[model samples]
Target: MATTSFGAMRGLLNVKFFQTNFSAMEHRSDIKKDNKMKEFQRILKSLYENLIMLELYPRSQIDLQVFVLESDGSYKSAAFNAVSLALMNAGIAMKDYLVATTSGLINNVAVLDLIYTEEKKQNCEFVMACFSQSKNIAYLSLNCNKINAKDFKNLVEMSQGSCDQISQ
Candidate 1:
């Protein structure tokens, strides 16, 4: 699950556990204990993968549950917001907060958080991921057209502003 808000990322994180097989008892044939265990194992495996990433900023374990409040062109931003909020809600310590945004050049206009319609018309695409707390860029990728130095700088600035808004 994921969530999005216009403000800082600290407000959306929550952790929860739910019974996946809650209704299985009503359908006895579907309530296989082994199957449930397997599902749990898969979840654990995913958790392990996340843990490996979290280890880089280790402090505490995070258990969070998020729900999307809205959908827009910035799904990655929303997901990052959700994760950051979840960690904060769980009281996990970290060196920095990460934020992400998508951008593209459409009809020669550089646009931030391009909507689906804009993306369809765009000739170039990019996503910028940054660490807001540290003011450091973590990732940048261009999909089609090459961004020259000037345009790259503008994109970075725009993305940084988006990150600042998210981290605040």
Candidate 2:
């Protein structure tokens, strides 16, 4: 995954995996404002271990390169959708389709796939990636300001309705 920032314009992006032998993740944020690299690594590990059928191939690496072009909203979610399709297109085996979305718990109401402006106005951000068939979370990331951790699960579930759309 990656993000670019120049003066005021900012973007977020990512790549994904398929059934392969080697796995590596790289993310660069020139602006150094948000540490998305850390989140990227976590997602990478989950994808590699949970979805990819690594046992099929040995001593090979499937170098997936993630790049950020332009983004005004939840690019990570878009990236996941793109990567999953790429993996499918490449004939890589996966357990299921992975769908993702970014939303916000604003004014006690959970919102769906939020844009940058809407995301910023809220006190928290929710990022989620899951299996379309299982509804199991393959990856989850959150950015919060003055919010309760206990409420995170419910908030995430509330936004699941949005993620379901992309999974299809």
- In terms of lDDT, which candidate is strongest? 2
lDDT (C-alpha, whole model) for all candidates:
0.57, 0.64
How many pairs collide in each candidate, listed in order?
5, 2
TM per candidate: 0.56, 0.70
Off by over 4 Å in 1: 1-72
Which prediction has the highest TM-score against the true structure? 2
Question: CA shift at 68, candidate 1, in angstroms?
Answer: 7.9
Worst 10 residues of 2 by lDDT: 17-26
**lDDT of each residue in 78-142, candidate 2, tens digit only:** 77877778778987666687888887777766777787677767777888988888888877878
lDDT of 1 by residue, 50-81 (tens): 33344333333344543334343454455555
> How big is the positional error of residue 106 in model 2, measured in Å on the Cα after superposition?
3.1
